[model samples]
Target: MSSPIRLYMSMSLDGYIAGPDDRPGQQLGRAGGRLFNWLDGRKSGGPSGQVYREAPATGTVISGWRTFKLAGRRQGDHHDGVPILVLTHYGDEGGDGDVPPGHARFVTDVEDCARQARAAAGDRPVMVQGAGAVRAVLRAGQIDEMEIHLIPVLLADGRRLFDHLGPDHIELDLVRRLEVRDVTHLRYRVRRPGEAA
Candidate 1:
């Protein structure tokens, strides 16, 4: 069986993933750093630490070009020893200095990217990060589940994760919910069409 594709993202209570002016230096954007405060770098013990400790089990990582770029190639290595696919619309149109060869593969098609990642991942789950990647995979109807780390702070203006998804309503089955210090984690299984809710 193919690996399940799961979208994992840290979002503010108001629904913003990154604050305004999210660039290379400002990875999460203005006050967006607060969204990730609950992450204890996989160290220590607790619900938050459990989340990070479990992340490395993911076989493949999918990220948007912007997210990959902002990581400066270093932070992106957090997945440590896993295949990382960077989704971009431009398709290798230069500006690859930050991306080390063999570290990541750039793909233009979301569906194809997800397929390749799933195949490379085998039975292990594939983790999807970045707003653009999440949006693309979601629009393509490729995401099997979503694990959102909802932060309490509200960034009124910034990049929203659910923007431009159209008017269609996608159903989701809540699988898990956990409240850790500074954040609330939610896991939902994306309900497919005709599937009994």
Candidate 2:
């Protein structure tokens, strides 16, 4: 039993992960932070706090280069200083200007990145984020489970989480659902091919 690759993210009702024009200065884009308003760090002991704390337990993180920049290049401190594997087309030659040398390892292959992350994670789950990384993992059938913090508002324009999935249908089994504050937390287990329904 290898470590599971899990994706945890907040998305709007319309399936948008971030608002339109989600650039460096703007970060999550216009009013996109609303999706995460429910994650109140002040209430760390509460349910919202539990959700905030869950991310830190991850042993490794996988992200897209664009998302790494959008996140202000925090390295892996977001996951309590865990190793971060960045997926990029430029490979080692790129992302060094902002990410530094040892803070992150740049990899061109999505599957290989995930493999390294899993090995580093050991028994702990590997946290996957960034739209590009998530999409690539999905296309590769590498994701084991997912936790979606579904927001109430709808952002008509922005990056969608389920785009470019091709014609094949990806099935997921609902594991848990919780309505807390202004967001609904949904957990799902990805059903691999030939798996029981």
lDDT of 2: 0.84
Candidate 1, residues 1-197, lDDT tens digits: the string is 57999999899999999999889778888998888888764476777888877778899999888787788754446466688888887776414644445557778899899999999888989999888889899989999999999998889999999998867889999998888768888999999878998
RMSD of 2: 1.8
After aligning candidate 1 to the native by TM-score, how far in Å is the CA of 42 from where it should be? 4.3
Error of 2 at 83 (Å): 0.6
TM-score, one value per model:
0.91, 0.93
Error of 1 at 22 (Å): 1.0
RMSD for each model, in Å, please?
2.1, 1.8
Give candidate 2 regions above 4 Å deviation.
Answer: 41-46, 95-101
lDDT, candidate 1, at 197: 86
Model 2 lDDT at residue 25? 93
The local lDDT score (0 to 100) that residue 125 gets in candidate 1 is 92
